[model samples]
Target: MNLSFKKPSVDTCSKCDRINMKLKYAFVDQATNLKTLKEHQEAFKAAYEEKKANKQLAQSSEVVAVITFDLQQCLPTTYLQTNVAFYKRQLWTFNLTIHDLKTNKAFCYMWPECEGNRGANDIASCLYDFIINQLPNLHPNAKKLIMFSDSCFGQNKNSIVTTMLMLVTRLSPQLQFIEHKFLVPGHTHMEADTDHALIERIYTCQEIGTN
Candidate 1:
């Protein structure tokens, strides 16, 4: 058979779903909405393709670095299967992974609920600190830094993170250009996800202790 079955994705794009729903009904006008859907999906595909191309470029060139970053789902500290321990208060652990396509390295920043809440400030700070430490190590010719992440406004798309990126570019002499882009919402599975999976597997072996 020429045709293959593609199962519906678990992560459905909200914008696509809304447009699809409208297209399903005869009453709703489809002209402009259909065009919008076409453009949106095309943009999504283009972004993914551009990231892939940039990754290849980064691997070969010293001037460019492509980094994909994402926050792992909160893991509860003192995790226990026992019925008594399940109800007890457990500190939430937050982890943010910044994976460089050029070096194939994942830098993780972690903190428990006691020290800080996982917010824009904390995320921006972690990224800024990482860049500061690693800036000296970057190649003398390095100039461009490309970043990929999901469009979670609170974490990635907000002004705080944007300002941090701006500050980094201004402060670092070698690093001049920084481009932060969001992946298609539903298709944002990234290298950072692998880090989360590995951490989760290890975390299950023993409880992750408090901060």
Candidate 2:
């Protein structure tokens, strides 16, 4: 008699479940109020469901890798003063977060701008770097790519971004198709927004000094 062996299954998380330590700290303040706690719970549940859905879709080997990205308007280092003799021009911080649905991870990149420029080319450069260099290693099995961004003409919704995406398909035989989608001008709630919220929370706390 011949016996066949099958390996025992090991459970693995579809995505990293590590909560941001800073975000958790912020949540502690919200937990103090009953109404705020309820709101937080609802938002948390919605976010979890979204992540779970993305994970399930990505399990299929042939699934297209969805890249959702957005450029945040540069933030000033310090709060603006109404009447200051110094006339300090605030330093700018450029932020972008690309969330890959296949990996269920958001890769954040921040650039401090001494040159004071945040144009379409700047956004394109960061995105192209990810597609050409980082994405292959992140999701090698990907066959198609879909990108989502807000309809900001100066940054994402212009011809330059469209042209770059077309060029990306030619970079690899494995990437057969690429498409870009714009969320309606008003309604966009994705991973990138969550990242921005975290940053804002940290910034606000720093500005107000946590009691």
Candidate 3:
């Protein structure tokens, strides 16, 4: 297998794009946009660096556990690569993936469309159960948690999830604190993404049907 390692630097950030566009076409105040763009990029780099440092610390010490979670793209309930399948309606399946940076272990909280929707409540419930019930048992020595995710206003970044985490920290005696951080909006490629890629590989190769 001829493989060459490549660093992924996808330019998909909306802020970056908008600023670049304004600069390119001379739309806005050039000085202001340039300063804003520089600040945004610096913040992006700083976030990545902080996550990196936290991961190393979590791996070395048991006091901290670093985790990143993401909701995978909805999967078709019954799928076949054919024209007939395209015309037919399909049930949707949702999965939220949580990956531990220290252990490289991933946990998937999944459900069918009939069972649940992937909204703020759905996400918060899953997280609540995991943090309150499972996380401590899994990482007994982890007293602090550092979590990373995208800045989706509806899901992870909203008031509901924030309040849930605040409550979780208070309710769970094992946890001293929880720190949640958002990765750069468009550049949130994470460890869970690799887990999803493996799942996708197997998913696409096989057929799924309701019995």
Give the number of the best model, judged by lDDT.
3
lDDT digits (tens) for residues 62-97 of candidate 2: 546777888765777674535672486777788888
Quick one: ranking by TM-score, best first?
Answer: 3, 1, 2
- Residue 49, candidate 1: Cα error in Å is 0.7
Point to the candidate with the largest TM-score: 3
The parts of candidate 1 lying over 4 Å away from their true place are: 1-10, 20-34, 138-140, 205-211
For model 3, the stretches where C-alpha displacement exceeds 4 angstroms are: 4-11, 208-211
Candidate-wise lDDT, in order: 0.84, 0.69, 0.88
Candidate closer to the true structure by lDDT (higher is better), 1 or 3: 3
Can you give the TM-score per candidate against the true fold? 0.82, 0.65, 0.88
Error of 1 at 204 (Å): 2.3
* Clash total of candidate 1: 0
User: Local error of candidate 3 at 150, Å?
Assistant: 0.9
Off by over 4 Å in 2: 1-56, 78-87, 206-211
1-211: candidate 1 lDDT, tens digit per residue: 7989977434678899889888887547789889989999998899889889989998899888788989998888767777887778878889999888877788899999899887899989989987778645755577888889999898889999999999999898788899998997867878888877788878887664433
TM-score-superior candidate, 1 or 3? 3
Error of 1 at 86 (Å): 3.5
